[model samples]
Target chain A: MLDISVPAKVLFHLGPVPVTNAVVAAYVSTGVLVVIALLIRRSLSSEPGRLQAFMELLFEYIDNQLLQAFGDHTRARKFFPLIMTLLLFIAIANQLSVFPLIFQVLVEDKPLLRLATSDLSQTLTLGLVVVILSHIVALSMAPLKHIGNYFRIGAILAIRSPKDIGNALIEVFLGIMDLIGELSKIISISCRLFGNLFAGDVMVAVIVSLSAFTQFIVPMPFIFLGIFSGFVQALVFSLLSIQFIAGLVNTAAANKEARLNKGKQAALEQPATA
Target chain B: MTLVIRFTHFSTHMEAEAMKFLAAGLCMGLGAIGPALGEGFVAAKAMEAMGRNPSVADKMVPNMIVAMAICESTGIYSLVISLILLFVV
Candidate 1:
């Protein structure tokens, strides 16, 4: 029988906490990543082996991506570790879903390991972290300006004459909308990853259960699709994170520049009118 | 002769269950149309750009995929809704 459940099944309890198969799988993947990183670090040398060469290439690719997005070295350098970690972790977690052995290990009749990315909680947490981190970066860059970006109180306060009231009110409304848009960003990103991974799992499960013959080779194409999408999604998620972080800072700086330009123009015009 | 109102619990439950399936199917099927068209348009444009500037294919490829992923978010939203309809509610 094919049983499809949206939520991860709880495998056991630890003290007061319940642990699901997804959590166990996530821990294993994290440990694997940590071990690989440590091994590579300890084996570093001037002359490169195949594994070292591959790791160098991956790091260069990520650096190039960050450079392309930020168009400068400073911000890219600051964000490299966060962006690189996100790319590696997501890619590993996503690709690890296809390991066949994970399906066979059962504890108490429940599968011991399931795809971590297939769980909404896991993806949602990732999305939340990225979005919140961006906000924190923005706040650190320019606190008042970042706060002003979402609340047009400054605009309202700066309205000297009654003639500007209409524009100030409109700016206030748009600010509220921008605040909501940030919340939607969290939902959109997490849901995109979760839906793609879970749908891929469902498709493969359905194909495998179609018939006895399907158990032979029918799932190969579907599995290939899953693998391709996993990589593409990892790339997309990292790229979007870089964009979000850089975009917030860029917009704030641009706004400040524009405001300065406008003030200068007004000062020049007032002297001429006087 | 007296007219009586009938309430068949089993039949109503079955009807509701069938409608849930229909709703999920329709939600996914119709919701996919916009993203499909949008992604097609994006891919076509990206291919055209790559063909014109073959040297920049590397840059264009990643940008194209990112745009397509953003376009696919609406479809993902619907997929989430349909999945909820199917498995949750």
Candidate 2:
């Protein structure tokens, strides 16, 4: 089994630097999206056929979700393509396990494509990208203030008297805690996704292996359950990503306001001694 | 002396057999109990929710499975231990 494990290798190597499986999956995912887009483009009609109609319904459903969640149609529209791509890739990957024949035929030694979300590296990379994009949007909206968010320099500089030093120290410590919280976001998001999908795969494998008679009949229901579970996990992951990004973009103004209020309080207390 | 040696060897074999059986029973028997309870609770909740809102059962079922999978992790851990005992030991 270990010998049959697919080694997702570095595509290129320069000195000690190496590319990774997640990057390759991203490219594969994009290729799949392009193919689907082309198929839709070719088949599209004002009066839709089955494929076109189905595609339209899916597109609308995802679009409506984005609109509802973000409440900014423009930003939602911009994000929709990426979100749709994720949904499609995850859906297809999850469905791959159902076709045991395809696995036997295509996978000479290893599966042609494992569920991308099952891999920790892929999910973690995607989560990190979402978080980083959120920060980018926040910073673009208020570059100088966002940069100052980490340092709390303005709060420190507001300390006019010796007594305020203790407060400044506390603020700095809180900022460090905030930094750690951001890192935890990546771990939680990735682990939650990887754990669910990988465990489901293992469960199916065990069920099928339990007995020859049970194998033919017993595992069928669980396979159906796996499909449903896969869809939900993908949706939860996307929703959490959207929520994280939305929170980051929306919180910048509130954070700045709170900082200003604190600075004001410190300044007012400073004059009492002087 | 030969009779005494043979008796000691037989006792050791019996002890080893007893340990294997104990390991297998404990690992699988205890492991399955938690997940069975968890899955039942989840199913009950899901059925109740579906009864209340039959229209959205499609959405609810999928969400329930995701929740159930998380709950089922403990069962999987137990299964792993049982397999290790059966195959490795």
Candidate 3:
């Protein structure tokens, strides 16, 4: 029986920096993705071929999701490329386990390529990117208001009396909580993807090792489950990214609504006083 | 001295055996129950929703799958613990 626990490492050095199998796997996956993209791009026609049609279906599905998520068709179209790429990369990485060579050839002394999502570094990096991008998008759409979100700059700058000190304290505390929540988002997003993919890989390894007879058929059901799981994890990551962006947009909307309501109240009070 | 030493050794062996069994079997066996119930409940709810609006299965199924994965995490944790006990211990 092969030792599935050990990963095959392909080593390369740039200056003093040593690159390992995980890095190679990421590069290889990226290359594969590029090739797939090129193939889809080349195959496009006035009347769609089967491959083009299938690709279009997937694209349209993701495009619709982006529309629903951003609540603006123009914004959705702009962000679709990045979000769709993330979804595709994750989905492919998750399903890479099904490739027989991944286990047989890749599992020598060290893994040449472990599933990209299974690596903690990769998942965490991806999570951080998502969070950072969400924040950037929020800032771009509502510059002054979004800046105020993190520091409550408006509240701090507008203090008119000593009693406002209490409100400012509350705002500072809420700001701290918001910062912690963002950090927790990074941890949860990374851990959730890592835990699921790693557990599935471990399960299949153990199940196959139990008995040679069981190897052929016993792991089939779990493999099926893993495929379903791969798709879900991909969707969850993308949806969570969308949700974060949506929340920021909604917060800006809410701030606008509050200002409008306050303006109305001020207008009504003026007439009453008169 | 010999008699006391032998008694201590026997008790240690028995304790190890008990720990091995409890860690490997009991943790996972018990953990499976909650996930099973949770998955079934989720599936039932998802099915009801799908039945009401069959056209939305594409959206619904993906959401259901995400919900199921979260529910499955408990079971996965138990399995990880059990495997650790069986192999690493």
Candidate 3 positional error at A106, Å: 5.8
The digit string of per-residue lDDT tens for model 2 on A53-137 reads 9888888877876787677788778888777766777665556566666434333343445556666677778788878888888
Q: Global lDDT of each model? A: 0.87, 0.71, 0.78
Q: Clash pairs of candidate 3?
A: A7-A110, A7-A111, A8-A110, A8-A111, A8-A112, A9-A110
lDDT of 1 by residue, A154-243 (tens): 889989999999999999999999999999988988999999999888889899889999986989999999999998898888888888
Lowest lDDT block of 10, candidate 2 chain A: A1-10
**Global Cα RMSD, each model:** 5.2, 8.1, 6.0
lDDT of 3 by residue, A35-132 (tens): 88899788778799887887788889888878887777886787787788888888877888888767555444565677777766788888999888
Worst 10 residues of 1 chain A by lDDT: A249-258
Alpha-carbon runs more than 4 Å astray in model 3? A1-10, A106-108, A150-172, A250-274, B1-38, B52-59, B70-89
| Residue A110, model 2, lDDT | 38
Q: Better model by lDDT, 1 or 3? A: 1
Better of 1 and 3 by DockQ: 1
Candidate number with greatest TM-score: 1
Tens digits of per-residue lDDT, candidate 2, B10-51, equal 767777757777787898789789989999999999999899
